[model samples]
Target chain A: MTQTALAETRTAEQGMAAHARAWLDANLPDALREDRPSTRRNTVAELCDWEAKLHRAGLVGATWPKEYGGGGLGLRAHLDISREIGRTPMPESVNSIGKELAGPIIMAVGRPEQKAEYLPAILEMRDIWCQGFSEPNAGSDLAGLRTRAVQTADGWVVNGQKIWTSGASKSRRCLLLARTGPVEDRHRGLVLFALRTDTPGVDIREIQSIDGERSFCEVFLNNVVIPEEDMLGSPDEGWAAATRVLSIERATNRMHRAWRFENQLNHLVSACLSDPATRHLAESTYRRALAEVSVNIELLKGHVETLVGSLIDGQEIGPRGSLPKLFWSEAHQGFARLALEIVSQFPVEASDTLRVARKRMEDIYLKSRAETIYAGTTEIQLDIISKRILQLKRKA
Target chain B: MTTDTELNPEDFVETARAVTTACAEAAGLPERMDLLAEAGLTGILAPEAVGGMDLPLGFAVPVLRAAGGGFLAAPLLECMLLARAFAGVDDALASAIVSGEMPVTVAWSGMLGGTSGVVGRAPLAEACARVLVLGADEGGVLVTPGEGAMVETESTLDLERPEARVRVTAASGPELSADAVARLRADALVLRAALILGAAEDCLSRAADYAQERVQFGRPLSANQSIQHHLARDCLAVETIRNNIHRSLSPECAVPAAAARATFVGAATLGARVAESAIQVHGGMGFTWEVPLHRHLRMIKALAAQGGAADLIEAVAADLLANAA
Candidate 1:
């Protein structure tokens, strides 16, 4: 190898390792470090506080343009920061919809005014965002959504209901997709509005999912008025915007889940270490099952690493994203379910790790049940994969 | 045998693909073997100093995939894998392999003890000049000349490859270290995975083509969502295995154990499903021997048991649990 090339490689490795070390030391708080599975429930205030810390460290928005409050680093820096953050069991970003989905779309296709107005607030965690793509009837068949956005002399009036909108009650804004054209014009006539959750007609109803978390909510838009300027991209082209958003969402969100699963698996192992009953149970009937889950998680880590590299290189993942999504979701559901069974055998203890482990396991177990349902159901993903990627013909 | 030639992976894959495709339609095994050997594929993995390309072992993966795609019956992969074993360990044997003076094959799994009686027939043992009897229980793997061993050729489901059960009464030859034996086993698993992936790719493509061309109820079979989803699921399996292979080849991977685990999942398990789905797409035509789709199915069934998927899974699990502990 050439001396110059070898030196460059060494420099890159050293810089990445140094950043990882620094982030590990400063970013994790005592509460988070002690909470093995991170059972903080991650309230908006706490999440915002953590985001502020991340911002202070110049970790947030590493890939977004510098003028709009991003670090303006390359995508490699973004991925490196993400990998470092994954070493801990911190709660997911409170501004996930804003930072991951909404922010990337605005950067890619939003007008300069939209980027300037929203990107900084998103990076600073001042504006938390929730997605409003899936209506009650449009969960998998998203384009079949019936939400209407009629243009008025002043702005647009939106009236519809969005179901399974997680964090709606807490979020300040919604990255909403509403029908602007005729109802039958599926996918073509939709418009994405950066709708304010506090708009006069907006109402959020909390729904307690099986996981016992009221994070999922139903949002009712009763004649909410969104100014024409708030639309994300061109009117009647929200389908294209939605596609790009979903692609970015799938690419970044799933990699985090893969790493988070690794963290959960580690906690499960730690719980087994803390109690003899669980350890014995794990060794006896649950060894292979637990081990297989571990294998899958490892496989997922490798898969995600490759994916992250591709995303950084600006390579198109396209329908291939469905592969990781399917593998990780099924793997997590299986792992979490097995963990609940095994952890249930452990003696009740006041130890922090044990206490947090039980809670995290229960939450993950129930939550994983929905993993296959959300972000496009397994069936929908399979359809996309087969029909689009594999070039299979539609049934006549 | 002295040479210092560098080999590029893309070139090797293209060359092997061309040769394997030509040999795929050959009349008999000897002709296919001759064609592949003439293409310099038989010694592709031996060090260039030994009259071979001495390409990185990573290159062997895609070549094997191509061979599996064509179902070429030349025992090319076994020779490459065996060449990896013989490199530096025996210069004379490695040179013979590069020049096609001697063709070697190894058992799927075997042991070191001669008195322990029959070790099941290794893969392609009947067709090779020598068979490497891998020592699973013992620390050292032994090389036994094919002529000295009690060999009996047997009919198998996978007609493209032949096998034999041999009792190695003369068990003496070059012995490999325990580490070497483990490395060889891991290499074999990786190559096996490539073959499985190749076969899966071909099966899926063939199934997709058949679905597109064949009409049921006045529409292509692919028009059916069920068939599309079946092929889609197979695509996921194949892609995931490919991802795993790329991961295993990364320089950061210090050992091939993790790669073997991936191979076990991708090759041993998914390979069978893909072949089955391929046949399902073919319906009645797939049931007959004339279509050649059944060859993949038979190969999958045979290869799935070669490296013990269950054991590989256990190893992967154990390593992870140990790390957790």
Candidate 2:
């Protein structure tokens, strides 16, 4: 392309980003803003409605195909939208599993009919999806999952228990992974199903998490009959599909996180500054720590932007995604701890903003503990970096 | 010297690595400067009129990276900045510095007031023919140390290139505007970030190689989970620094000064941590002078101090607080 074309492309992207920023500023209500003291506890229906509105505004699913109720503006525009969403202290997507993980994998390996059916519904927020990859014994060793799915004359019958299935209680669909072969076949003979959660034998029980949210659930599939059309791909394609989902989960899933991290930091500082007793926490007492947090936020942004650029250039992220995964988890956890410490010091007569910040930070601190534990544990990320990225040989 | 339009910075990396490696064996400062000038590195950021390529500061990053990795004792970063600063203001001195005739270093701390003042943190000031100091008016002044000026070597963490305190009783040279000084300071932060990143990469490479070769407890040290985790963390830190540096240099950076300062501070702090981990990976041999891991660690510490990481952090914090809404 000529230099003029390149300049034009940049101008267009900047215009799109500016439009997104302005749209979000005008649309997002203060009652839904996480950073605002007036924010109320939004219900699942309210959050889902807001997300669907975001989709309508082209702020969500910007990269999904236009045939699937998406804007189809491409990854750069998606990133621009995500950045705008992140800059504001808005709530996380209630159906992120559907949009980020399940939707992308379905696009990759789903049948055309499946994509036509599931993709649009996901974007429309009509079908909330929950991932069913982790089992009682297969959290990190996902391939060792023992969920049995035997094909009967009618359909496929699945009997298994999945743990840590976030949003399962509210989800309408499950991206369930089950094995068709014996236990010895670790990665082979596995099958993925877009199982309906309201199926007769399927049971979902909420598990209260440390953050006092019952988002995490234990999904029990007892002779749950799944239709043949619901199979994601071929029987042996499950491992590949699962790995693809995991990699996306590690890399580009929720690309707004780094920006959100910065928003959280700014919220903490702003809250501290709202009160005389707490102002010194950000001004002088914990200045170095706050500065370190600011620096770490930049590093996290660097990682995310670099990955996005690489993806746009058609380069495979592969295990290189673990870098940001490890860095952000550890760094954000540190920031959460620091934020809690600062907010915990607020006086009894602190400002309402400080009280709201304290509550938000307390939840963040509790939820951050699971950040490293989930999305492949810190140890798993380290192992991937050492073995896959560094290619270090294992002990003989 | 080549014109800026005719040169590509990526094309100079191999030559820079080779020349800087050769400089380690050079007899003295002049030979080192000669080697660097021969490779066209000294004039990379200077003007074509002053016999320089007049390329962007990005062109000098690879050269300084090589210098830092090879531990070349000459004041290359200082010379490049000084030569660029003197380009139009004093073409003769810029030409001299670029042609390896006059070796120069910059006093990163203290300002020269009236006729004399003490300036410190000038690396290899005793070996250089000229030193650049900030003036009281926030401009830049080139000082040719002579009878009235005294150079005092300050014991520092970096033994090979200890910073010097120059007491300038009489100084006179071409003056640079305040804008030039500010630009030079920002440029210095970026270049130092690149240098520290290079040193950290070298340390990581050496540590990984040693871990693979060294056998302990009936297996290679790399097999140990603890050792592998350490090296992996170092790799993450190194990549973070590299990415941050690139981001700071990219045109998309919103605030170039703040980005550059963040890059320098991140590189210094994380680069030192990486070096420390590299030493731990090497066991006892890493602590000895023969191993040379300590040199990179020392250089990183000195760079952090010289760049005023603590003060930068405070400034960053102050900005964050003041912007609170």
Candidate 3:
């Protein structure tokens, strides 16, 4: 494109962003958009409706191919949409597993028939997917998962249990990992499946998290049948497919997370400004901590931009993907911890705003603890950097 | 943001790196400065009209990093900051330095003042044509010819860059505005931070090499999990400093001071850690002067004290508090 044409295209993108900002302002429900703890609840039906509206507005899947119900735009469009989404204090997207993870994986490696079958429902939030990868024995060593899937005449029978399954209780479908060969076969023996959560002999029991939420659960499978067509790729291609999904998970979701982090800091800063009492609670130490958090958040933002840039340029993040994952997770956890420290210092009979802030801070602190553990532990991340990116030799 | 007369940063950095590599084997400051001036790094930040690259301070960061990586003897970092300080305020001196006709070193006592007091130690003072004394105000800076100033050489840990105590008469030289002084200070910190980062990266790279080659118990030292984790964490700290530096240099960051301060403090502090770990990874050989790992360690120690983290933290706290209030 010519210089003027490029400028015009940028202007048009900015215009789309402005329109998105206005649309989100007009459409997002007050409760979902509000900062109060009471409004923080994610009611399933309402969130599903919101997701459908978002998909209709072309904001939910802007970077996905147009044939698969996305806006068929580039990364710039997604960034624009993210900037607007960051404005509202909305809860997590109710169907994030389907929308972010499963959808991307299906698009990248799934058969065309699988894409046609899964992508639209995911965009519409009609098929909520929860990951069933981490099992009782295979938290970090995911290849060790013993969720066995025996091939039957017309399908596969899955049996075994997955632990720490987020959104398992509310999900309609699952992106699962089950062993197709002997348990000792490790990664090569694993297969990825898209299984209906309501299938017979499948059990999802909610596990109360530290924050007293039942979002995470344990999924047990006993002869739960998955059709041959439901296999994500060829049998035994689960590790490759899951690696792609994890890379997408680390790259794409972070824009919103980074913005949310910014919003959280802004809210705290505003609160500290408005109430001398709140400011006095932690005083200089609090301000210093806030400063530290701000600098680190900007660092994370910069790191994310680099990662996303690599993605935009069609460069594989490869082992370098671990850098952003490690940086953002630690930055987020540190920010949440700072919030908790500030909030716990709030005086009794605090205003409703302080109370709400305290509650959210509590939730963030608890939720942040898992950030390092899930989606690859901090230890695992360091290992990847050391052995893969840094090319350090592993012990025999 | 680049004028047609401006140097392309990539080309500039490449040329700077070549000069750096060539100067790596040379022992003396004059010889190194000749190579550096040939590459135009001594005037990299000066406008092209004066035979300089006329590049922004951000562009000069890599050159500083490369210089720091090799422990080059040229006063490029000091020259770049001084050139930028004198850019609009004192074009004559800036132009002279930009033209590579003069080599200048800066003394950060507190700020520019004409008062007869000890200017903070000037690095490689004997090698420069002039020493610029910085005080609280821009106009407060006194530029004294390098030889005319009362100078006391001090033995320091960072032997690569010699340090000296200089006393100058109060208000003796051309003064700059406070705005100019602040910009100059920020630029100086950024260059120093990049240097620290470069030195730290070299430390890590050397340690990794040592770990890979040095065997223990029939395996490479890196084969040990403890060593792997140590290097990994140090690598993260280095990456953090790198990210902060890049962020600080970006156009959109409204307050570069925080990022600069963060990078400065982070680089020095973490650079020290990496240097220390690098020594440990080398076993007893690291303790010997022959290993050269101790040079990075000493530089990091010197840098850590250059601009105290306490002041940066105070500034951040005060800014955040003021914004909150």
Best by lDDT: 2
Full ranking by DockQ? 2, 1, 3
Grade the docking of candidate 1. medium
User: What value does the lDDT take at residue A37 in candidate 1?
Assistant: 46
In model 2, pairs of residues that clash are none
Candidate 1 structure quality by residue, lDDT tens digits, A15-59: 753576587676587665534545445556876988877876777
Q: Arrange candidates by TM-score, highest first: which order?
A: 2, 1, 3
What order do you get sorting by lDDT, best first? 2, 3, 1
Candidate number with the higher lDDT (1 or 3): 3
lDDT of 1 by residue, B227-321 (tens): 88888888977877777777677664434566557655656777888888899889999898898888988877777766777776777666656
Error (Å) of candidate 2 at residue B299 is 0.8
Model 2 chain B lowest lDDT segment of ten: B1-10
lDDT of 1 at B156: 68
